[model samples]
Each structure stands twice: as structure tokens, then as C-alpha cells.
Target chain A: MKMISENVWEIPREGKMRVPARIFASDILMEKIKADKSLLQVKNVAALPGIQKFSLAMPDAHQGYGFSIGGVAAFDMDEGIISPGGVGYDINCSVRLLRTDMMEDDISSKRKQLLEELSKEVPAGVGRSSKMRLSREELDEVLSTGAKWAVKKGYGTVKDLKHIEEGGSMQGRPDKVSDLAKKRGMPQIGTLGAGNHFLEMQKVDKIFMPEVAERFGITKPGQVMVMIHCGSRGLGHQVASDYIRAMENKFGISHLPDRELINAPISSELGQDYYHAMSAAANFGFANKQMITHWVRQCFDKVFGSNENMDTVYEVCHNIAKMEQHMIDGEKKKLCVHRKGATRSFGPGKEEVPEDYRDLGQPVIIPGSMGTASYLLVGTKKAEEISFGSTAHGAGRVASRSEALRTVRGEQVKKELKQKGIEVWGHSSKGLAEEAPQFYKDVDEVVRVSDALGIGKMVARVVPLAVLKG
Target chain B: MKFKFFDHTADIKFQAYGSSKEEAFKNAALALTEFIIEEDIKAVQEKTIEVEGMDEKQLLYSWLEQFLILLDTEGFLLSTIEELKIDGNKLKAKVKGDSAENYKLTGDAKAITYHDMEITHDDGWMVQVVIDI
Candidate 1:
């Protein structure tokens, strides 16, 4: 195995490490890592109890709460540490795409109208709520049942669930979720909360792997697509907040360094409870995106006249922990895998993949920031060998929001994007400034790193045509 | 002292400039608390609450957030702050507050999150407090 490549370095298992740690990046990315403590966070994850194989970092790896963003770590179910930071505040923060038969030429003239309609139909901004406010019971059901809750409510078709990761519902107990978390989530079922979340209208620009593209049903170069990037919103935030506090004190019980890295053994009562609650919130996030997908279809119908021919490309959650099975040293073992700011990249012929896509491999949807190109990629078998079947999520932030706002004005960024023919919509100009294209690293570089590492293979490139931000 | 308002992604921030570090921190706390409760400081009476911290900066941050939390969750309108002292990393502050007839809270900030939070002194005796959204 190429443990240390041109930019990557592997920390071999020693002392407390149960497994090695592999970081995927170039020297340039590593320089950025040195400026921050994300590498230290990755190293900390390697020290956790019962960690398996390797703690992997994608090209976009950066400093984050407990586990660094773009970090992937797996642990045996019987022995492991589960920290809220590993999953992050936005429980199921994920990406969803919809492909249409319509071409770029068909929707060029209606771009502004489409953007306006989308902004109105999709609730956005901080504390934004949908027209449909659910009662406490309904909220619980949403958390417990996930996208199935929305489909049953007639928000979408059952077929939509098939294309979603874990069928859009992570099966587990919801009663473990706190009442406060339930209250916070009750009013925000389909809302798109602010900060880095967005809805972008795109056109298939180019095909890289024709075989994978054909399997994913993406053929024409100008075919229109819509991608929604969001998550569990307030409910998930509350869950994380409540649990971080719990862990802060609970980790004291177990005696771990760094209060920010507070955690409990996977078998502990506190850990099990947090996992159940986390899973419920993840479910809520799944249902939240599914509901928004329905409204997206409605927005498309308003513009294109009908959405019956539109199809869901895929829905995948990047911030989550899952119980999975992987081979370690030629022995198959069950492990709890934490993929924070990383996507599951199960290769072709995996059972978890949908029947239609089993031959094509899991679809890895990576949405670049506004004015940048998004991508569709397929999982590779090498990912299992390197990163426990995980890949980079997006163009990780290089500059903080404030840094972006200081360097780029919202109106100017908007002007530049418009000059490029990208239609943009959001609650405020200030919000737009925080998500300026300059705030992020080049996603093309991130994709290249993953491709070079053989974790994922690019299938298609998508350029934005219309955009919505919160 | 001169204070400037800045727009954070999810919160409004204030940067205060002063000849002394103590003044900078005190004013920063005042600015943040004032944003939570819109009221005239002259009209409110003063009652004090003491807070201690492990470090001077931590004490400053915790002191401000503690007061803000009281104002946010308990509806306490702070009027004045005094009796501040820092010995090594430890700090002690006596915060003054009084109940107002009616005050409206504008934002729904649950708590001061520690994400990317920072407090630093600039070259011109200006102190900046960056709060995570």
C-alpha cells in the first residue's frame, strides 16, 4: 500500500492506536492543514477505543468540532467512542439532485422566474419556517420515520426513497431525542436554514466516465438539473447542542482529554442514547430534504409546465455515523463508521446500493459553491481499501465567512455570478457574501485528489444556471 | 471609546476600540448586552452579580456570555458593570443589572457557541470579539 504519497502521510498503528490513519491531500492542502489543528483532530480519532482499519481524511479535510470535517473513522460496535462533533451540528446535512428531460435552452428565458418561484416556495434564512407547521406528534413521527413520513403525507412518491441513502430513514429509536429538540424541530420540517446551505439549478456540462454517466441516466450535455443542499436544521442543531453538554460532563466520567472531544464508549448508556437521538435527527433531516424535493418538483412544474418526467438523481447525507461491516486484516467485522463531511462511496455490487444502481456503484453527489461547477461521481472498490468506503463531501472552506464578507461584497459577488449567467436568490445580500465563491477552495482540485486516490471516479460535471441560498 | 457594528453570518457583531484592554472588554460586553435588550441605561437601577474565570480572556468571554444568557433566558436587563479584576489567568467581575418595565428581545440566539470564537487585541489598542454564528 502507498501509505505516504506525494502529499499524503499515514500514521501507522502504535501505542493507543487500534488502526492506522490515512490522510488524502497534496502538499498544498497539507500546508493548510498545518495552519489549523484538523490533523491533530484526525490523530485524536485514531486514539479512540476499538477504531478499525484507518481514520481517513479526504482532500477537503479541515478543522471542525470533535472529528475534523472530511474525516472518516470506523469503530467496533462493542467498543468505540461516539462524539457529537464527529457527526456535527447539522445531523443529516446532505445533497440531493433532480434531473429533468428539459435542456438548458428550454429554461434559459425563464431563469429569473424559476429562481423567484423557488425562493418563495422553499422557506429559507435563519428561523425560516414552512407554511406547513407540524404538531409535536407529527414532528416526532417525522424524526422517527424520516422520508417515509413525507411520502406518507403525500409529499413524494415511494420510489423517491429507493434512491436515497439508507432509504432516507436510519432505523433506530426516536424516543431518545429530547423534548427540547422535538420542540425546536416541530416548526422547521421543510425549511432551509442559513449558512452554506443552498439550492442550485445546473446543466450537465460534460461527461468524464461515459459508462458511469450512462448508468446514472445522464446523457445529454445540456440536460437541466436541480440540487438542494441542506440538513436537519434547528432540530438537529438542538440535538447536537444538548448532547455536547451531556458529553462535556459525561466524558469527565470516562476521563478523556479535551472537553471539546468529550465522548462515551459505544456500549455505554449515554452513548447508546446519543446514537438513538442522533439517528432520529438524521431521519428528520432525510424527511426535511425529501419534503423540499417535492416543492422543487413543484417549482419545476411552475416553469417547465410539468414535472412528471423529472427523476430524482440521488440523496446522500454526508454528516452521519453508521453501523457498517468491513474487512480488516482479512477478517470481516461490524463497526460504527463516523463520516463527518464525507459521503459513503460503496463500490459497485454492494448490497446497500439500490437495485438499479448496484451495478453502477453508489452515486457521490458533490455540489460546489455558487459560480463553481458541481460533480457526480461513482464509488470505487479502492475506497474500501483506503477510506472505509468514503469520499470527500464538497469544496471545504478555505476562508471563514467573515473573511469572505470582508474581501467580497454580496452585491459584487452577485454581479459577477450574473455576468457568468448564473441566476441567484437568497434572503439577504449579507448572506450571499458569506458564501462567496472565494470562501471555498477549488472543488476541481478536491475531486482530482479523490480521483488520484481512487476513492471515487468523476462521472459528470454540472454548471450552475440558477441558485437559491439561505 | 469608539465602537463599530459588523454583520456576522447569523449574528450582529461589535468591535470596540479603547486606550486600555479593560475598557475594550468592558465596552464589548456592554455592546453585546445592549444588542440583546434595547433600553436606556440611565432608567435602570443597578444590582451586581459576580463571575470568576480561569483566564483573563476566558473570564471576559464567559462573563459577557453569562450576562447575555441571563438577559436572553431570564429577561434580566443589565444597566452597568463594575468591580473587574484580573490576577494571572483568573478574573472576577461584578455585573450590575435591573429589571425594566418592558424590553423586547430581537434575536433567537440559543447560546454563545464556541465554534471559531476568538478575542484579540489589535495594533491600535482595539479589541475584537468574533462570535460564531
Candidate 2:
């Protein structure tokens, strides 16, 4: 193990570890990891084919399916492997931020109305789908095209696509996705499904870096910001499920150490097919968020009477794998980076970023639970050197939902959030209890570690004013 | 003795009572798997599986999830549970199951969810488990 810094450590390849392991955490975080099996999962990821540099973990790392939740590992295109667990079941489960010209005072009186409208417009809960339904052919196009499908459908503007990561579409063949996945996805596009999915109305409460905030068009304390957290919904879930089962069947009874760690080499047909389907789902997720953004604008218009001038700040997906070139061992090489429960933190001047904000790097939108402080951060060069240009996803869970329900009442949590002046709307009170802010670690602490490690630099802090939960 | 469905989330948690902790865990897994597959436990083909855990509670969790994984992946529904032995964190079990396609369940579970799950000894023995539907 190589200690890159006091907080970061590298686990060099030993035995079956195909690559090394890189961990980003403070001494205190390391203690927490030692108490959990997340570190072991990270080591297992290092064993996957095509992994380069190290299997990296962010500060908010936690045990998950195959790879640790806050993990990032890049594999070579020719030899790397992709696991469904690495991308997670949620597909492009992601976060989108929209900085508005209006201030908190402008919307405070309408918070309740705003939330109600949002809840009404955005379907939530299990088996919930939006009012929009697509034919089988349309669904196929959506699965193949990603956000570009939504733009062509006029669900969102071209400018919205420009601000999104990868131009809101990762180009590749998506015809490989299964028909079953497409069928499962057709009805769920533009819907908000359950389990930690939400849309929150927030205000820029603090600005940590004035220049960065100004460049991103975020200014004036109390300015309202909208954050939406959701994913590719059933389509993404089906894609992951389909591939996982296929992989298991292929490796059946093979004495694989873990069933969830099933994977295939990138060069194989199975691997390429999974990648195409996953990318399609990621694109669908981008389109889903874009559709939600359009509805959010409509909700705002109904409440505030105008959305003609509202703009999208940034839209990004946290759960995904992509092909990118990064400096590895002093030489740039192509790699397929898998980031689950982690966000890309590409430093400034990268062509991937929009020209206007190229110098400021990508805007990393990290959402906290409703009634907590969310943050907007920018990628740093230090992150490229250390974490393969990645950062923590959110305040990782400290307790499971069931554990929270034992002590925290759903009604009580709802009342508490209301008392805090945040309007809340949810499908069920029980769902709220599962997502109680107390069930997670302090998001501020998670962001603080990222800033301290110089992976992501904070730009602004946002506090929720209204929330719509699934 | 009695089954009570807790508040509706993605998973459904129910409480069951037995005379001993071991019995309670066994019954909980049986009930949970039954709830997931919505079928009679008598038709499944008998299969034995072993899972090692760190402690009795962890062992119970793994044991239940092992059956859950089977039910989820292979559509194997439990028909009969013959034995459950726990030695520290290690759990060994023999369960019978055929196919889940023939079994009728109240709901189809996507997978065994981590929403709300617990195994505790109360007056007799009580367990609460939530299955993702």
C-alpha cells in the first residue's frame, strides 16, 4: 500500500488484484471504512480486467453491490471489464442544478403552491409513470439516443443539452439493449420513481468562491436554485438486471468469489452490448432529467407566472461508465471509467466542458437531504492527479432506512421539515422517514473532505426551501 | 403466531413470533420468501445452501438473503425448510424448493431490499423484514 498523502492511500496489486487501489479519505474516514467492508469491495474492483491506475474510492465511500458506492475505476477499452454493480441499478441516477434569477423572497410565499404543483406534475412512488407514454418504436429511439431524443421531441432546449455532461448523450450503438428493457422503460420516462429520488427548491445561501460562482451565472445570496435527483427509472434498472443475469448465467457455478461481481471483458460482445445499453440508459436519464426540468419550469411558471427567462445551470449523472483519455503512468491512454455513487470532477481547460465555463471546470452538483445544505463545487487539477478526476456523490448513508424508522417517525420528520420552513410533498409519510436527513452523514462534512483533499473546490451552498419526494 | 404488515414502503415488513431465536429466524426467512414468491413452500425442490456470517444475527441475514437471491434469480420458491444450524457466524441450512413460476404471491418482488430488516428476540421471538416489490 502506498500512502499518497496522510488521507489518501494506494493499494498496489497483490495476488489477484489486476490493478492497484486508490482511496481518498481522511484519517477519521479511514477509521469508519475499517469498521465496514467497503474497502474490501474496492479491492475486489481492482481485480476486474482492464482496470487502470487504481480502484479509487471517494471520501463518502460505503459498502455496496460489487464496488464501493463512492468508487471510481477506469478500465482499458481493449481489456477492461464492466459490471452492472459498477454502474448500479439506478442507471444514470444523477443530479441536475438550475440557478434561477429569482430570490428566495420571490418564491417564499409560493413555496407550498410550488411544491404541490411539482408533486402533481412529477409522478412519484412505486410503479408511477408520467402522463406521457411512448410507443415501442419511440421507446427504442429514446433508449438509443439518450437526451438527444428529448431535444428532438422539444421537451427541452438545445442550451440545456450544452450544459449537460457529454452534451447529454454518449454516442455509441444502443441497439444492443434488450427489448424487455425498452418495454420496461417506455412507460417510466419523465417520471420520478421512489427511493431517494426528489426535487428540491433551494437558495444560494453562501458563496465560497466568488469568481467561480460569478462565472457560472450564480450570484446574489438567496437566489433560488432547483435540484432534481432521479435516474433512468425502470429502463435503467432492467438494463442492469438483464446484463447481471446474463453474466451470471455465463459464469454459472464457476466459484466466483461474489455473485454480484459478475462482469465481462470490454472486447466481448456481452461487454459491448452492456455498454451500449448502459449508455443508452444514461442518455435516457439525461433526457428524463431534462423532461423533469421542463416540468419544473412549468411548475414555476404556474406559481410565479413566468419561465420565459429561466435557465438551466448544469445537469450531470453520477452513476455511469464512459470512455475518456486520462494520463496514466505518464502517458495518456483511453479508458472506460466506471463511477458509481461518484461524480466526475474534470479540472479547468478540459474540452469536455463548455467554453464559457471551461476555466472554472465542471460544476459538481451535490444534493443533500431535504432540510439540509446542498453544495455546488468545481473540479480541480489536484483531482486529476489523485482521484482520476472524481469526487464524492453525497452524504453517504450512515443508517439503513429500516433502522431510521425505529427511532424517527415519518410524521415527526415531516413536521420538523415544515417547522424549519421547508415545504414538503411526498407519496407516503413512511417514504419520508426512510430519507430522513439524520439517516445520512453530515453532507457538509463530506464536502469539506473533498475541498480539503483539493479534489473539488466549493463554489456555493444551497439550502432547501421546498421539496417533492418520491 | 401473527403476521402484521408494517407501513408500505418499497419493501413489506411483517412480524412473526416463535419460541426460540433460531426458530424465529427460520420462520422469518420462510415468511419473507413466501411473501416474495407468493407461493406455497411445499412445491419447491429441496436444496441445501450454506452461508457464513460474522455472528448469529449476521448469519440470519445472510441465510435469508441467500434464499432471496435464489428466489430472485432462479424463481425457486421454498417448499419446506428442514434444518438451520448456526455456529457462531456460520449458518448451514437445507431448504426445499421447486419453481417460483407455479407459486402465486401477493406481489412480485424485484429483489430483497435493504429498506427495513431486523431479527430480534422479544417475548418469544420476533422478526421484521421488508421485501422490495
What TM-score goes with each of the models?
Answer: 0.83, 0.81
Q: Which ten residues in a row have the lowest lDDT in candidate 2 chain B?
A: B106-115
For model 2, how does the per-residue alpha-carbon lDDT over B1-133 read when each residue is reduced to its tens digit?
A: 6455564422356766678766777787767765554435565377788887544544555566666456534556776678877666677778777775464443333334322355676578777765543
Per candidate, chain B TM-score? 0.72, 0.79
lDDT of 1 by residue, A1-470 (tens): 24477646787876665677788987777777666777777877888887776787888888776578899989888878787878877888999888888889999999999888988888887555567878778887887789999999998789889999999888746688877677667767898777778988899999998877877878889999889899887677777767776765555424543345667788899888889999999999889888889998998888879887567778888999888888888987888888999999989888888888998789999888878999999998888777889999998777766567678888998999999999888676777887888778789888888888888889999999988887
Q: Residue B9, candidate 1: how far off, in angstroms? A: 13
Report each candidate's C-alpha RMSD, comma-separated, in the order given: 5.7, 7.7
Alpha-carbon lDDT, every model: 0.77, 0.78
**Which stretch of 10 consecutive residues in model 2 chain A shows the poorest summed lDDT?**
A251-260
Residue pairs of candidate 2 with colliding backbone atoms:
A50-A80, B38-B104, B38-B105, B41-B79, B44-B97, B44-B98, B45-B97, B45-B98, B46-B96
Give the top-scoring candidate (lDDT): 2
What is the C-alpha local distance difference test score of candidate 1?
0.77
Model 1 segments more than 4 A misplaced: A1-3, A12-18, B1-133
lDDT of 2 by residue, A155-180 (tens): 77888888898888875355867776
Per-residue accuracy of model 1 over B1-133 as CA lDDT, tens digit each: 5667665433355677666666776677777665544555543555454555444444555566555445422446666666665556555656666653264332333334444444566665555554434
Q: Which candidate number has the best TM-score?
A: 1
CAPRI-style docking class of model 1 based on DockQ = incorrect
Superposed by TM-score, candidate 1 places the C-alpha of residue B50 at a distance from the truth, in angstroms, of 15
* Candidate 2 colliding pairs, count: 9
